[model samples]
Every structure is written in structure tokens, then in C-alpha cells.
Target: MSEDLQETGAGDRPGPVTATATPTVTDTTAATGRAYGGADPVPAASTAHVAGAGRALRGAATGGGRARRAMGRGRGRHRRTGRVTATDDRPATFRDVFGVAEYRALFGAAVLSWVGDYFAKVAVAFLVFSNTGSVLLSAIGFAISYLPWVAGGPVLAALAERYPYRRVMIICDVARMVMVGLMALPATPLPVLLLLLLGASLLTPPFQAARSAMVAQLLTGDRYVVGLSFQNMAGQSAQVAGYALGGVVAAIDPHAALVINAATYAASTLLLWRGVRPRPLPVVHTERRSLLRETFDGLGFVFGHRVMRPTAMVVFSVVGIIIVPEGLAAAWAPSFGGGSQVTGLLMAAPPIGAVLGAVVTRMTGPERRLRLLRPLLLAAPLLLVPVLAAPPFAVAFALVLLAAAAVNTVLVPLNGLFVQMLPNAYRARAFGIMQGGIQLTHAVAVLVAGALAERLPVPLVIGAWAVCGLLLMAVSVTTWPSRQVIAEEVARAAELNRAPEPEAPAPMPARPPVPAQPAMPARQPVPAQQVLPVPAQHAASQPVTT
Candidate 1:
């Protein structure tokens, strides 16, 4: 939000970098409601008022303001404990998730789109430089690709709520297809091509927002986590393949690559249109206010919420640190004292590590992940701190691999948690905020590292960045939600999912004499409708790299 936040040129931006993984099932979480694989505990309490966990899904259709208030539930309350119980150790298989027809279609479309997008980023950068022979122009074009996420992510993502998610994705894909097609035409001017590229890039936030929202709908429980693992694998793999393919194809004919990029969208359009069934809109136009208001509210909820704010910073920090090696590979590779292939090897390490991390996380149960949380968080950055010693290529690669893997392990479940807590109404806008945060953080991290590399030794810069990252992560850990809090969230999700298959109106309760049970005090709703720049957990599969 591997889910990737795409940045052109270096192939660095992490997408948990856009995929969000769900927490694995456990007895503690199962106590809340265990939506699958077993009986859920019937609470002695009316969980409808159960803080954020209780009211989240119930509040979904209400409005963003209500959802925001519901999500704001767990702040400052980590000191308290919640009822926890359930048991389901069997992990959801990729086969189980992919068995859903719509997910297969979504996956197919997304794969084609990602491959094309990555390839196009490289091809276009080359085309820009070739046409004007200005490295500066080339860089600007690459930067421009990221502008949509920064400037209009929430706004564009907010727009997705106004229509069926499938339609938003389809429309965005088709619009992108037209624009890329124009750019591929021979003799197109650089300025025009750039504009076309901008138009195409701008569609990403909304498209991604829609896709993330849809994924949350299609997958639930451990199945969602498994789906994200696949997304992470495909996205990272696509990055390496795209960048490599783009270089070769651009060398031969940049326009030809552009044509292929356009074709992928065309094919994606067909896949989405035909393969996925359409669903109704999340927020009807009548329910929405001005787009600006929607974005503002979403921002407040995303960033200002107590739990999300800190977690998001942690996610951003981890992704920011893991991405450092890839961007600096060209200058840093020589330190390994290896042959020319060192650059390629070092560049590939993070994504490979990222994929490994995703797999490990999928295999790990929730309790273990929770146990691994703080230690691994520190390890992610701590492992990289030794780079200042200018270790051999093997040592450097190992350190990078270990660090990247640690980051992904923490993030996969976090991505899923964000989805589990938020009301559906705000998920798309939530993704927009996280996506923007990740991209912005990545851009800044890379820029800072690049600038520092210019002024100092590559190893020194990387080591220093990692040290700073370590410190940042230390602070972020303090903000993590307690295990008690997560248990509550899981239970609430279970309760909601088991909402008794809509029952027929019962004959007027024959025994009106039975007294209603006493319920817990309702929480005062926070001033509603705030969304922040992705504080951390991203696009519900869609958060910032998420």
C-alpha cells in the first residue's frame, strides 16, 4: 500500500508496500466471535456497545462519522482487560481464498495491472530522458507519478465510495488505458506524454482504494491474511520483473513497452468487467457530503485515532527503513567489493526478504505474531545498524534480508487489523490516507538517503538511517495496542459476523414481562469524521507499504 506503494526508478517503495494481512486465529481472538471454523461464545453482554470492537461493523452503514467514533474506542483503555476465548489453529490456505470466484478475477486483474504499471514506470522514465537527454526531467517524471497519492489520495479514494467499487476500478482502468495508449503513440511530445502519464497515475489512488475495499469484502478471517500474502508475493515479484523487463524493452523501444502497458489495462478491464460480479456502492451520493469534507473526516480518523496513529507511524518507519537499501544499491554496491552483479543482487534482497516475511507471517499464528511484535519491531531496524562497518556483500545482503523480513512479519497482521476495526464506509478513504502516508514517507526516506549518500559514505548513511529508524521504532512500540485490546477486536468481529442469519420478525414477544438485561455504559462518541495521513496499517490490503 506486498501488497506496494509504487515509486518509479529505484524500485524501492514498499507496498505492504500495499497488501494488508489479517491476524491468524487464536482462542483469545476467538472469544470475541470466531467468525469461522467453530462456535462463537455468546457474551453475557450486549457487545453492540462494546467500545470500537463492539460497535464497529454495526456502525459501518451509519456513516464515516459514526465509524470514526466507533474506531476511536480503544484509546487509553489498554490498561483494562476484555473477555477472550475460542480455538481454530488451522491456517486458511491460498486454495481456500482463491476458491472464491471474484477474488480470482480481482487477482488476475491486479496482477496484470501491477506488471504493466511497473514496466511503464521504467519505460517512461527512459523515454523522458531519451527525448530530452535531461536526467532532471527524467527524475521529475518519476516524481510526478507519485503526486496523485500525495496531493489527492484521500479525495480520489473518497470518490470511490460514491459508486460501486467495481465500477470505480473499471472506469479508472479504462481511463488509464486510453491515456497510456496515447502516450505510446510514436512522436508524442514529452510534455503531452507526461500529462497523459499524470492522468493515468491519478487514477491509482481511487482504483487501489476500490480494490482494497473489495478485498476486505471478499476475504475474511485468516483467509484475508492469506490473500494478502499472495498479494505481497505477486507485487514484489512484479516489481523485479517489471523493472528488468522495462529496461530491456525500453532499450529496444520505449513506445513498445508503453503499448504493452496499455494492453494490460485493456485486458484488466475485460477481466474486471466480465469476471467480477458488481456490488452496490458503499456510500451513496446522498449520504456523502463534499469530497473535501469526506477526505478531511477520513484523515482525522486515520491519523488522529489513538491506535492507528502510532501503529501507522511504526508501519511507515519499517517500510521506510527496508526500502533504503534498494534505492542506494547503485552507489552502495561497490562497498561489497563484488562484481557488477552486486547491484542487482543487493537490489533484489529486500523484495525477496519481503516475500519471505509474508510467507512466514501467514504460517505464524496470531499469538506468536503478537509475541514476536515488539522484539521483531526493534530487530527490523537494529539488524541494519551494523551496515556502517561496510561488511561484505554476503553480510550486507543477509542483514538486509533479515531486516526486511522482520518488517513484513509485523506488518501483514497489522494490515488486516486495520480492516477488522474500521467500519466498511470509511475503508476506501482509510486506504487513501495510508497510501499517501507510505508514498510520502518512502519519497522522503529515499530522498534523504540519496542526499546523505552524496555527502557521506554509503555505508555510513545507511547505518545512520537505520539507527534513526531504530530510535523511531522504539518510540512506535510504546504506541502499540495491548494484547487485551486486540482480543476485544477479534471477539467483536466474530460477534458481528455471526449476526444471526437475518431472522423473521418473531410473533410479538409473548412474554413481555421478562425484564431486559442491564447493559454496559455507552461510550461518548468522539467528534466524528476525521481521517489522517496513513498513520500506519494500510489499505485494508491497502494500507500504506503498507
Candidate 2:
């Protein structure tokens, strides 16, 4: 039994004392009856005992029950041992994520691919402009990479579930290598070049989906969030590296840059084929549904689920608005008497800020990051509102960098939450859907912003659009799901993922056959007649007795 005694003093006389006796391993609370560390309460009984002279005098000086209650408020109690426990508040580290070999390989492959992609984008844009001499065609070429996502990204991503992840990635890489190599040839027509680019871009969604699904498999728990941060950081760094070098390389010769891009794809394919292990597809052959059905199902699942619905809304809205700055950079920079050099710097600012934001977010714990989500969303568009004043190029650049940082801060936590909310089986399709939405939003934002900039000052167009974004954010914040709801969903999803998969049933044993019974012979009439003799004396005696 466990006992807690309370002594109260009133003048020289002690107030009625109380003693609570609880069974061993049962919870005990203070006189105030509040729970400590999620423990259950036990009943208390009043008891009187005379104290020695010294003890009585000491008891009369201090208020005992009230002091004990104050001390127990924040302490956690062990359910089994009834002991107080302290909470651990340490932050996560990069070692927690990058130490895994699989993640390292995936991360390396992604970096090579991202850098190659950006390089090719710049080269293709330069080639289109040089050949056609039309800015519109160049913009269209730049936009074509994103167009495939809007057209059939989800359907293509569903293919990831139908094949091995390694195979999907390698095939996509090889296809891109061949397509980019064709584009590098001098005799390739402009129309054919554009078509090849679109065809190569069409394979991107499945490749990315395969990579994402593999990530979910490689990293678990808190490491998943940290891994995602690292991936985002690497991608941003690659963009900076690729764009800076692409500009320099294209100046020498655009064809050379295209050739280099094709080489990167070949290198990426080799790396993935050698370094990454092959894994079975997420959906088994017997269990697989049609691509269209799965695509629609993924869409329905994201929009119809309560937690995911709000998360999707928040991510899409924030991304749609934040991307506008980079999307409009080409037109926005020229307005300030700057050429391609200024445009490249403006384009690079957001990704640099994004890299910084990822590093900062990596140092924070999950709970703290989630708490910052709404605040960061509100800050992003508000930060961009200053562009309304028509600040100088340098001032506008700083403002945009800050705004991009805030937007990235929101994304890190939001993405972690969304991934946690999804079932593991649907991760690829869901990722494809989310990524496609981001690409489509970005494409539309750039096109619309560029068109509006033609009729108005670039600063005015960006600021007015930002103001509209702020209103949209307000609605998103107002409708944001409560933390408790999201936590419950995350916990439930985690539980489902942790549950072991059911094993196939064992086959039954075969049984032996029974022997057949023999048949009986029929009686003969001649044998019956031979046995039918009777005595005359016995018959006459029986008749007289009757």
C-alpha cells in the first residue's frame, strides 16, 4: 500500500489530518484532487494522531497540503511504479536522417537529376529563343516541362505501383538521356525537339513518385521529416548550382550544355542501377486496380479525407502564391533596366532562401514546427505586400528572399504532417497528385502574372496578386484543422503502418479413401426344400393340447 499524510495547522492546534491509502502501483494525488502526469486519483480518509512536542510545533508553522499540491502540478507520474518523470526536450540532428545508406543513395541520385534538369531547362530555352527569335516560343518551351504534369501526372504516377521502383527510376533516366541526346543533335528540327522534350518530361511524374515512395520506406518516425528537409535543401542547392553553371555554359555553346545534361542523365542512371536496391511494387499484381481508377481514387481520398483536405488546401495555396515571384522574375527584372543576368539572380533568390529555411526547420522538433505553420503562412504574403511601394531592385530582392523563407518554413511542417496523415499504400499516388497541383499552379501563376505585367507595372501586378493571396490565406487559416484532430489522425496512421501484415493461409492435408464392403449371396429354393421335414407324432400331440 502507498500512503500520503497531510497535516494542517490552525494556531497551536492541528487541523483534522487526512491519510490516503492506495494499492501498490495505484495513482495518488494531492489534497487539491488534480491529476499529476495523467495519473488516476484514489480516495482519501480522515485520520487523527497525536504528534510529539517537537513535531507538533513544526507542523503548526507550515501549511502542508497546499505546498504539496503546488509542487505536483506539472510533474509526470509513472503508471506502474508511481514515480515522477521528466520530459525530454532535445532537438533532432542530421545524423538521425543521413546515417541510413538507402537514404544517402536516394539523396545523391536526386541531386544529380535535379541539377541535370535545371541545366537542360536553361539550354532548351536558349535554343528555342535562338532558333525562333520569339520570346513567346521560348517561354512556351520553358513551360512545356510543367504542362505534362497538368495533363496526366497522376495517371503516370500510378504506374509506379505497377512496377519495381528501381526499374521505374532507371527507365525514366535512360529515356531522358536518349531524348536529351536527340535534342543535342544539330539536324533535329525545332518541332521534333519540342516534342522530344515533352515526351521526356512526361516520364518525370512516375520517376518522382517512385523516389518519394522509396523515401517513405527508407525513413520512419522523426527521421522521415528530417530526411525530407535534407532532400529539399539538396534540391534548392542543385537549382542554384545548375542555373549558375547553365548560364555560363550556354554562353560558350547551348549544344554543349545540352550534351552535358544528357551525360548527367546517363550518370544518374548508372548511379541508381549500381547503388540502389530493387524493391517490389507497392501494389501486388492480383491486388492492382486500373490506372484511371487508382488515379481517381487517390484524388477522392485526398479531397474527401478531413485532415488531408485542409492540409492540401494550405499547401496548394501557399505554394501557388510564393511561386509567383520566381515565375514573374523574367519580366520583373527587365522592368528595372536589367537583362538576363539580373533575371537569373532574381530567379535564384527563392531557392537560396528555401535552403536556409530547411536548415532552420531541421533544428526544430516536430511539435514546435507544427505550431509555427499558421504563423508562417500568414507572414509569407504579408511580407510580399511591401512590393506595392515600387522599391528598387535590390530592396525588392531582399523582400522576396524573406518572403520565400517564410513560405518554405510553412512547407516543411505542412509536408511532414501531410505525409504522416496518408496511408503508406497510397503515398506515391498522393505525392504525385500534390506535386502535380504545385506544378500546375506555378505554370498558371507565371503565365497570368506575365500577361498582367504587359498591361501594368510589374510591381503593381505582383503586389495586387499578393494582396489577393493574403485574403486566400486568411480563409485557409480560419478553416485550418485543429492540432488535436491532426495529431489523432497521425497517430492512427502510424498505428496502421506499424501493424504487421497478415500471412497467407496454410494449405490443408489430403485424406485417404475407405475400402468397399463385400456383397452377400442369394438363397436357393432347392436348399430350402431339403431342410423342410416334420414329425407326425409331435404334430398330433400339439393339436390335442391346443
Clashes of each: 38, 0
lDDT of 2 by residue, 337-359 (tens): 89998898898889877987888
**C-alpha lDDT (0 to 100) for residue 429 of candidate 1:** 88
TM-score of each: 0.75, 0.74
Cα lDDT, model 1, residue 510: 70
Give the alpha-carbon lDDT of every model. 0.73, 0.71
lDDT of 1 by residue, 1-546 (tens): 100101000000011101133333333233223221123333222112244455666777878778767755522122234322112234567898889999999999999999999778988899889878999999888778889987887798888888899999999999999999999999788899999999999999999999988988887656777788779888999988888898899899999999999999999999999999988864444565899998999988878765466667777888999888888999997776765699889888889988998888678644455446667888998999999898887889999999988987777766866665565567788988888888888888898999999989999999999999888877666545543454454444434333234767868857567788899899755555644346455635554321
Total backbone clashes of candidate 1, pairs 3 or more residues apart or in separate chains: 38
Candidate 1 deviant stretches above 4 angstroms:
1-28, 31-87, 283-285, 338-340, 487-546
Model 2 residue 26 CA deviation in Å: 27
Best by lDDT: 1
